[model samples]
Target: MKLGRLNHIGVATPSIADSIRYYREVMGATEITEPFDLPEQGVKVCFVSTPGETGVNEALHSALNGTQIELIEPLNSESPIAGFLAKNPAGGQHHLCYEVPDIAAARAWFEGLGKRILGSTRIGAHGTPIFFLHPKDMMGQLTEIMETPKAGH
Candidate 1:
């Protein structure tokens, strides 16, 4: 199967507001979008984009010029970010999502290799079909495979 572009890098944080401030004030990055809550995912997310080397936040921002940095703050203890933070108190990179042409084929390929899946495939907020490959199968990184919605239904 063919690999697609890196969609976004998910960063787990204890407080979305704090992180937002850091990215905005300290880093001097412009907000690409406001923070929005995704109850289904049990987290609040915000996107920020900057021009070039202005501060610490913009430093990492340049590396992800074409992509986005998804700052995710867990809403409750049951959230995945909470679990990740429990293990890594300072928070950490949660997962990486990749746009794909065929999520089914990607899933099948991983399964064929005797890999375990964290959960069954499901449609995301934007109607994109997505699935997560167990971290064990990917050297400690949770890999998400996503496909765009079809023309009709």
Candidate 2:
């Protein structure tokens, strides 16, 4: 499997609005987009860009060079983010998403090593196909493998 790059760092928060303010005002980070509800994932998320003093719209669309910090607040108790927050009340880093050239190949590689997957491959909140490898099988951290869309696709 050809691993592409570090896609984004997912942060599970109790409140999306509060998290956005914390990242923008306190951390001096730029808000890339307003909080968008992902019904499929049962959470509201806001992407914040890493660089630049002023928040620009282009930052949200450009995924190649910039790194995005994803703030996720679950809408329901059954949501994965909510489950994570329930486990850790303080709300911390949830998962790290890495871009891969082929999700099938990546999944096969991990399964070949006898690692357990949290679930089957599914479309992620960001519209990328993704799957999570169980933390118990990993080094005490849940790892996400995602396949980003091609230029024309």
Candidate 3:
């Protein structure tokens, strides 16, 4: 049940393209991944990498480096985040992902403490097994628990 590093910050967006442009033009983000669709999750996904974290040495960190921003857009009306987009219109931060050494152990620990799990563990954007803790049980914020990524991933 050991928690690893903060993996990423999930953001719901009306359009990944627009989000990418803003991140690049407004924030000077230079490392953005090409947007891809995850039909199984009903969303288009892209990652925005951040550098220049305070007190952090870039040479010491790997590719995952600082926490990333996951820009997510509904791929269809059935997308899980569609309702969020409808309410937000402008979209906003969606969830926070944290890495865990073992998905099963983390899940069991949370369950033992009476926290509600959102769904069955599934493959996440990072290609690692992940599960969500219900917002109601996690301080009104959806929290994603993901398996720690392998080196050089």
Candidate 4:
């Protein structure tokens, strides 16, 4: 299957509050969405616009059509993000997300290539289907494949 757009870079942080501060105060980010929790995913996440990109928070219309930075922090000890933070207390890039026209097609293609898909497709922070690819098959970077959101989402 053909790859789609680079959606967002996922960052695992020990604290979303701290990361938000860094993006806003030091990085001068002006368009950050408020942090929200995904209990099913066991993380709290926020989206920060890439530096100098406007309309990052305008997802309903006119938002940046390219890459974004997604800040994720563990919601509890059992959270998946907790393990990431344990390995990196200072936090770092956790994964790269790319949009796909059809998630099932993408999954099938990856499986055909013998790439390990981490888990069943699940609803992600964007309210769309998403799944992760193991870093081993992806040159040391965790990859997230997401179904492109429909218009008006």
TM-score of each: 0.78, 0.84, 0.91, 0.89
Candidate 1: the clashing residue pairs are: none
For candidate 1, write residues 1-153 as lDDT tens digits: 776767677788888788888877888767556778889878888766544334558646554454667788888999988898999888768888787888888889878888888888987634688888888888889988788446762
Q: Say what the RMSD of model 3 is.
A: 2.4
Between 2 and 4, whose TM-score is larger? 4
**Taking the tens digit of each residue's C-alpha lDDT, what string does model 3 give over 64-84?**
576899999999889988999
Residues 1-153 of candidate 2: C-alpha lDDT, one tens digit per residue: 665667788899998888888887899875568888888779888888775334547644454555678888998998988888989886889988888888898999999999998878998866778999988887888888889766753
Q: Which sequence of candidate numbers ranks them by TM-score, best first?
A: 3, 4, 2, 1
Highest TM-score, which number?
A: 3
TM-score of the candidate numbered 1?
0.78
lDDT over C-alpha atoms for residue 62 of model 3: 54
Which candidate order results from sorting by lDDT in descending order? 3, 4, 2, 1
Worst 10 residues of 4 by lDDT: 57-66
**In model 1, which runs have C-alpha deviations exceeding 4 angstroms?**
50-65, 148-153
Off by over 4 Å in 2: 52-64
Clashes of each: 0, 0, 0, 0
Each candidate: what lDDT?
0.77, 0.81, 0.90, 0.90
Better of 1 and 2 by lDDT: 2
